[model samples]
Target: MRPTRAGTIQDAVARCYRAAGGVEAVAEQLGLANSTVSYGTEINEARPGGIGVNHLARLAMTDPDCALPLAEFFAALAGGVYQPVGGVAEVISLFSGCGLMAKECGEAQAATILAATTQRPKDIAEAEREIEEAIAALTKSRAVLTSLQSGAA
Candidate 1:
């Protein structure tokens, strides 16, 4: 996955947290920016609390097997490949395990979860839509490729 620019201060803080290894690490690495990292971490910790109407709708559109790659993809984004945050390695580790199923629990659901935990919404609905669309297109393309290969054989 390609890296995305850190769109919000929260995104920047998350990047810092990942780079520094949790909130404390981020603070020390950034030279006394601990409070910022701590604040960001606290906000992010509240996103998983509730279910929303949009979340349920998105959930209805998802498949079960697509979560791991999605998480890894998002982790990659958070790791600052494009944006170059301070402590990306740590961020990658933290986000790498978010399975697709967990990640795909619908945009609103995911947002709600994130909001519940972190008190901030990551605005992942657009990304989720694109991913789902991409997955479908890829699956179709793969099926076509397989068919062509078998036919040629």
Candidate 2:
């Protein structure tokens, strides 16, 4: 059967959580602001019983991929037609790479590269040069990551 939005969101979140070692890591991988992911987790934790559609709707607005059908589900609950939110797959795909790298390269190495890419250096030219060097280094790391992915490590 084809995957649904809700299923996809759930899967993506779960995979990210597992790969990143936690929701914070997942949030970082997703490029989401830490406060946002923390708030969402807090809400979910507070409502251990369950949160209503309305609450979920609010969450979807803040973090669209938080749940499935996401926009539609929220809309339907808000007395509107179900309108799907597109591009969630792309978001998931992008974040999934971090998880893949984490799994393949080990968290320490993955974190090193992630930090390097996300940081803003004092000198733009220097940063660019550093990034180029990092990319070149990836030629070696990629071989290792690839082997790890293939279970050859």
The candidate scoring highest on lDDT is: 2
Once superposed on the true structure, which residue ranges of model 2 sit more than 4 Å away at CA?
1-22, 30-36, 44-69, 81-153
Question: Which residues of candidate 1, in runs, are more than 4 Å off?
Answer: 1-122
Clashes of each: 21, 1
TM-score per model over all chains: 0.21, 0.21
Q: Which ten residues in a row have the lowest lDDT in candidate 2?
A: 83-92
Candidate 2 lDDT at 52 equals 36
What digit string (tens of lDDT, one per residue) describes model 1 on residues 1-153? 112234543444344335334556534544545454355433343542122224222322452222223333356767822212222222222233233224444543555555556653354554546456444433344444455578731
Positional deviation of residue 32's Cα in model 1 after best superposition, in angstroms: 70
Deviation of model 2 at 71, angstroms: 0.6
Q: Which TM-score value belongs to model 1? A: 0.21
C-alpha local distance difference test of each model: 0.40, 0.45
Against the hidden true structure, what lDDT does model 2 obtain? Answer: 0.45
User: What is the C-alpha RMSD, rounded to one decimal, of candidate 2?
Assistant: 17.8
